[model samples]
Target: MLGKLLKHEFKETWKLPVLVCVLVFAVFLATYWYLGNIPPAASEDEISMAAMMAFLLFTIAVICGNFALLIYLAVRFYKNLYTDEGYLMHTLPVTPRSLILSKLILSSSWMILISFEIFFTIFPVMERFFQLLSTDPQISLYTALGEYISISEFVLLVVVSVIISSISSMLTIYASISLGQLFGKHKVLASVLCYIGFSAITQIITSIFMTPYMVSYVITLDTTTAAAASFQFWEFFRTILWIGVGISAILAVLCYILTEYIMKKCLNLD
Candidate 1:
């Protein structure tokens, strides 16, 4: 039953992400070709200006597209489970828990997909542009990034961070929307307020929780000492990554529980 629900949700929601991905890739390809074809004699200033413009445009589009995807997912959850359509949805034999889980899974997957697309798509283009600008034959972006840490460990940490953070964020939005359904009217407005309130609270809590670790990290970064031992830096950062993963997992679980309870008990489709 949950599988069927997820399939239906994916079918309904896939078009938006597909369209976004196509548009972004098209723009990136066009920009990459244009930048690549710039004449050898083109002045440094001209090349720099063109590259900067392209970078800014692509960056803005990627950022906007990612936000739009998240907003769409949030809106879809609210409409499917809290508005008129929810009447039909609730009549299904599926449990509220199943419905919420399906939505969370799909939403988080889409967020992770977009994050990867942004990273993979923009990174190579930017890397090439910088390489061309510097004309440094030995420059390898990937190698430079992996210099301070084990590549496998860094990649594992990144993947975990992205998945956990995306799930946490999606669940936060879901919880907010569920809470908003309690309002008799102006539910949309209520949802927006709830999102803002949740975000602010989360930021405050994260800041407080991370401050001590951050302070300790800074204190350890004596250039002379750090230069003598780079492994210490990797260990410190790995510890930070684990801390973030733990926090995010806890938050995601809490938000999931909150959303599930609200959907099952306080659901107001009135």
Candidate 2:
């Protein structure tokens, strides 16, 4: 039953995800080509302006793409399970738990997919761009970043971070929307307000929790101990990363439970 639901959801939602991926690739490739083709004698203003425009487009493409996908997930969930279509959906043989699980699984998968696309699509092009900008034949992408960790470890940690954060965010929205459905009217508005509140609380909590670790890393001494400082920074960063990952993972589970409970016991698809 969950399998069928996932299949149906994927069939309906694939277009936007694919389009976003295409747009990201196109934007990155266009930026790469433009940089490589810049005239040898181009003015500083010209180069800077062009590069800035490219970067701005790249930023917009990545951000808007993911934002659109996230909103689409919420819209589909609401329409399919809480609106007119929900009448038919509820008549299906599956339980509300399966319905919610299908949504979460699919949503998390798409979130991870978009994160992967953004990281890989921009990395190689940006790597070459940096090397060209510096005119250093030996300048590799790993030159600065490899100081504290191997590329594999860096990539692994990045993927782990993305997965945890993405699922946490999606589940938070799902839980917010589920809770909002209980409202007698203006459910969408209620959902938006709930989301804003959730975001605020989350930000405050995460900040409070991370403050000690952050301060410990920041209060250390001066420039004479550059290497030591860098090591301290890395330790600080690792601690922060793990802390964030832990918090996000816990939140994701709680939100999943909240969403499922709402779907199962408090659902008011009016």
Quick one: best TM-score, which candidate? 2
lDDT of 2 at 223: 48
* lDDT of the candidates, in the order given: 0.82, 0.81
**Backbone atom clashes (below 3 Å) for every candidate:** 0, 0
Cα-based TM-score, every candidate:
0.89, 0.91
**What ranges in model 2 sit over 4 Å off?**
39-47, 132-137, 225-227
RMSD of each: 2.8, 2.5
Candidate 1 global CA lDDT score: 0.82
Write candidate 2's Cα lDDT for 48-83 as tens digits.
455556666877888898899899888988888889
What 10-residue stretch in candidate 1 is worst by lDDT?
A: 38-47
lDDT accuracy of residue 73 in candidate 1: 89
After TM-score superposition, the amount by which residue 152's alpha carbon in candidate 1 deviates from its true location, in angstroms, is 0.8
Work out candidate 2's RMSD over C-alphas. 2.5
101-156, model 1: which lDDT tens digit per residue? 89988989989988878877887778766765664557777776677777888778
> Can you give the lDDT of residue 105 in candidate 2?
84
